[model samples]
Every structure is written in C-alpha cells, then in structure tokens.
Target: MAEKLSSSPPARNIFQRLPLLGTGGVVLTMAIAVMGIVQGLRTISPWLRIGNNQAKAEISTLVVQQIRAVSELTTTIFAMETVVPTSQERQWGNFTLGRTDLLYIGYGEVRAGIDLAEINEQSIQQQGETLIVTLPPPQILDQKIDVERSRIYHYDRGFLNLGPDTVPELQTLAQRQTLAKITAAACDQGILNQANQKAEVALASLLKNTGHRQVEIKTTNPTVCAIPSAQGLSRDKING
Candidate 1:
C-alpha cells in the first residue's frame, strides 16, 4: 500500500485583510513620515536662526540705550595670541617616577573698552550742536582661549611616558597660562589706549545717529592699565 504524502505549509499573504496598514506596512509608512518631517524642519532652520538673531539684537539695542544712553554706542574688541608651557612630575624617594610635560601654542583673545554704562546724564554736556561725553577708563571686558584653534605644538613624556593619558589636565593648565600671558602682552602693547581711541570714533558715529551732529568723547588714562608683571613679560621670556 502507498503512504499519503504530508501537506506543505501555506504561502504568506503580502496583503492582509486588516484596514489601512497590513503586514508591517504601518511601520514602513511611519518611518517615511518621520523622515519627511525632519527634512522639512531642516529646510526652515535657517529662517528660525535669522529671526532669533534679529530679535536678540533688537533687544540688546533697547537695553543698551536705556543703560548707556548715547555715550558709548560702540565698543572696541582686541585679539592676541600667546604660547604657554606646562610641566608636572611625580617623584618617589627623590627620584622622578613619572612626569608629564607639554607645550601649548595657545591662541587667546580679549576685549577691552570704555564702560559707557558709567556714563550718566551728568557725564553728558550739551552746547548747541556739540555734545561732550566723559567716558570711564577702559577695562578688560572679556578674555578666553580659543581651544578649538589652540593646540599642543610640542610635548615630552619623559622616559616613562605617562602624559598621553593625562592630556586633559595639561590642556586645562595650558589654557590658564595662555590667558594670563596673552592679557599681559596685550596690556603692555597699550591695548587700553587703542581701545579708547577706537571707542571715541565709534561713539561719535553712534551719537550722530542719535541726533548729535558733533560728538566728543573723552576719558583719562588709568593709573594702571595692567599689573606690574605685564611689562616684564614678553614672548622671549614668557616662561619666566
């Protein structure tokens, strides 16, 4: 007698009887929708940026006008570069077991300007078409190292070579040194004087826009633009 053959498995149906999405079609459709939404958002991102920037600038202008009046409508920004070296050592029984040594050629920038906020109604003198504004002494407004552009130019890990792993510490130390050095150098270069002169020109133009045809900005030099060490420090002997 012949034996009956076993029945084969049924083929999968590409389309199910369910409404709307069927056979995992909903997942595919949802993914496509999400991608389209993301693309649309990206296309409009630039406009959003422009709107935010304009709003911020407008707000800044209003606030400045209220606080500073028409005395200092502009500021002078100064930039400079400096290099700093950092070294640290771990010793055992008067013998150096590990040492981390690195030299960073840092690029730092600083801004100095006369504080217009110091100007009040008393500081402004009006005589016919001429307006005289007495500005406060210039000061260091901001200072920071450009970490993205500044980097290690040279390094020595000594014989043990433990520095490769502690690079973050070296970077932090270098940044601090670089800021101090750059600020000192800039001060020695008479950056305050430069800021004063530039500020005068900028304020004059700003005053013109505020209905003052002839504007004069004046300020006295401070007793100390920078500390005593600033003059002593230079690129040639910065390490000292």
Candidate 2:
C-alpha cells in the first residue's frame, strides 16, 4: 500500500503569530508599533505647520490688498451751525472813530475717516487662527462751510456809518473763522475717536465676511487734528 500523504497546516501571518508571544512579549510588540506611529506623526508635524504658515501668509496678503482697494473710508460727519461775530474798527490816533460789527451765522461740516491706502502687509498680523489688523490714525478728511445755509444775521456800521466799508472782507473772514471753529469743535467732541470705533466695527464685519472667524481691529492714537487751511474763501463767502 502507498504511504498516505498528510496535509500540512497553513502558514500563520505575523499578526496570527503574535499570540505565540507571551503576555510580556505581546505588550512589547504593541508598544513598539505605537512608537512607530508616533514617530511618523512627529516627522510629519513640521511640514503641516509650514503649510499652515504659508496659508496664513497668503490670507494676510489678500486682506491687505482688499483694504487698500477701499481707499479712503469715511466714518463720521459732524455738521452744525455756529454764530461768528467779526468786527473791523476804524481808529484815529488812539481814539476809536467807529466799528463795523458783523454778526454771522454759519453752517459747516467736518468729515473724518481712515485712508485705507496707507495700509500694507506690515499693518496685518496673524496669531494662530486669529488675524489682527492695525489701522492708520484717523484724520480730518474734509472741512466745508455751507454758503447757502449761512448768512449775516446782523450788521451795523456803528453810529452814523463811521465803520469801514468792508462788507465783502468781513463776510469772507466770518466764513474762514467759521470753518476753523467748526473743526476745533469736532475734534473736542472726539470725532476721531468716533471714527476709530466705527472703523473697527466696520472692518471686523468685513473681515468676518471674508472667512476670518476671528479678527481683531486696532487703531493708533489720533494725531493732532490739523485744521484745514482756508481754501474755501471763494466758495464759502456769503454774498453781501
């Protein structure tokens, strides 16, 4: 009789062979696998961080460009009427000959805003997922005296018209003075501060819409409000 052939057992894979190890060996093997996985993650971490940094940089650049395109962002307008009194006196050797008193009412407007064109990459910063934007100081954008709404409320050439015949000059002076006073008043009323606050709110909203979930808007202390020169003399003067 021919010898009967016996079938051999199938070979076990490494995973199947793991049970052949004692408890201590099994623990050691598992620990080594865990270490390998950790090592792989450690090696990949720096590249992931580098990628994140690059994306943040690109976002910052795009934000700056969008802000620059907005140009001047006017935030506040202060409008009011002020009474201005101007007088020209005629004198003769320390003795008052007469005085021309002009009482004028003037309406003026002061506009304040941020010049977005001044923003650049340096103005923006990234802190993790949050973005920080530093805005330029607010400035007096424009000052104007409304000639249509302004007029000479009272005029007197004191006592027999002894005062100088300077109607046009007095009116022009009143307009100029009105503009200066209005600008000063606006500054005192914290118009720049108001502009800064409004700008923050506006920018926060804008950046959020651009997919930035966390954003911080910051502003610098406003510089001295430089009153605009009297260039509106021709247009601001009241017709006498």
Candidate 3:
C-alpha cells in the first residue's frame, strides 16, 4: 500500500545553506577586510598624532627666524692704511739683544655701527601704531689690523743682531699703533655720525616687517666714542 506525502519541507543546517561562491559571499568577505583596516588605523592613532604635532612645532620656529629681521646690523664702511715708523729694542740678561727699526705700512679697518641686538623690552615702546625704539649709542664696533694687506716697508736689525729677532715684535707694535691712529682719524672724520644715521635708516626698514607702520630710532647717552689714548712711540721714544 502507498502512503500520502506531507505538505511541509524538510529542515537543514543553516551553515550548509549559506552562499559560498556568489556575490553574497564576496560581500561578506569585503566587509570583514574593511573592519580589519579600521582596527589597524586605531592602533597607530597615537603615533600619528605625535608626528603631526612635531611637524607643526618645526614650522613655527622657521617663521620666527624670518620675522626677527636684522636683529644685529654691522657695517664695514672704511678700509684703509697708514704709513708709520716704529722701533723696538729688547734686553736679555746683561746683554742688549739688538734693536729693530721698522717703517710699517699697515691696513687698518674700522668697524663702527650700532647693535640693534641691544634692543630690549625697555628699548621699544608702543604708542598707538607707532613704535619708539631707543637705540644704543654708536661706537667703534671693532678695530682690526689686516695682516694680509700690511707689509714692512723697511726693517733694520741692529749691528750683528745680538738680540732674538725682534722683527715680529716690531711688526706687531706697528700694527697696534696704526690701528689707534686709524680710529682717531675716523672719529675726526665723523664716521660715528655716519654710522648713527645709517642705523636709523636700516632699523626703520627692518622693523617695517614687525607690523609697525612707523618706527622712531633715538640714541641713548652719547659716549666719547673715540679711541682711547695710548702714547705713540717713535724710535723707541714717545713722539714728543
């Protein structure tokens, strides 16, 4: 005898019915890959943040350098030489070494200018849009003897040259004297005045970048910015 079939369908494992080779399977795999990438980014988030902050700090430092324009301005205006006579004699034990006579032509360079670096918080005052800066006094920045440009026009070593060769000493003395003379001459010729005027112009231009439409430069106590006096020696004696 034959039996009648039931109307309901048979049940199966859910895993067995899942799509394995079609678009649905591919979509699920892609979703999992996206989730993995997101997790990786989260793990390195702190390191990425540190890198970004460091880059920003470096850029800010560069910006400051560009803004502090001409904080120190130096001027080399005059380079010249003078011819002078100098002599030196040395004594060792009981014997006089020997004397040296030198006619030295030395190149003297005068470095005179105002240092804007001297500008302090007190030096600069703001009144509305104008900037008032009290500049330091103009003075001789430096006095140098150019060895390469200098030469001994004449050198005389005493008879038989008993003393240690004093040519170098005489040369050095001549250079020292020449520099003093140059400084005095520059002062007489108004080098300091010129430097002060130039400072005003240069600093005004530099401060323009600092957002100040107007800059007023004034000098502090005007000092006796002349070369300190030293006895000028001639033929081993003070030139009276």
Clashes of each: 0, 0, 1
lDDT of 1 by residue, 1-91 (tens): 1333322222223233354446459889889999999999999988767654454455446534654765443355556667778888877
- Provide the overall lDDT of each model, using Cα atoms, as 2-decimal numbers: 0.67, 0.85, 0.68
Worst 10 residues of 1 by lDDT: 5-14
Q: Candidate 3 — worst ten consecutive residues by lDDT sum? A: 1-10
Please give each candidate's TM-score. 0.60, 0.71, 0.59
lDDT of 3 at 158: 67
Show the colliding residue pairs in model 3: 97-163
On lDDT, the stronger of 1 and 2 is 2
Q: Which candidate should be chosen as best, given lDDT against the real structure?
A: 2
lDDT of 2: 0.85
Candidate 3: tens digits of C-alpha lDDT, residues 176-235 = 688788888888777878888887787677667656567677765447866744444233
* Comparing 1 and 3 on TM-score, the stronger one: 1
lDDT of 2 by residue, 40-99 (tens): 999999876766667777887999988888888899999989999999999999999999
Best by TM-score: 2
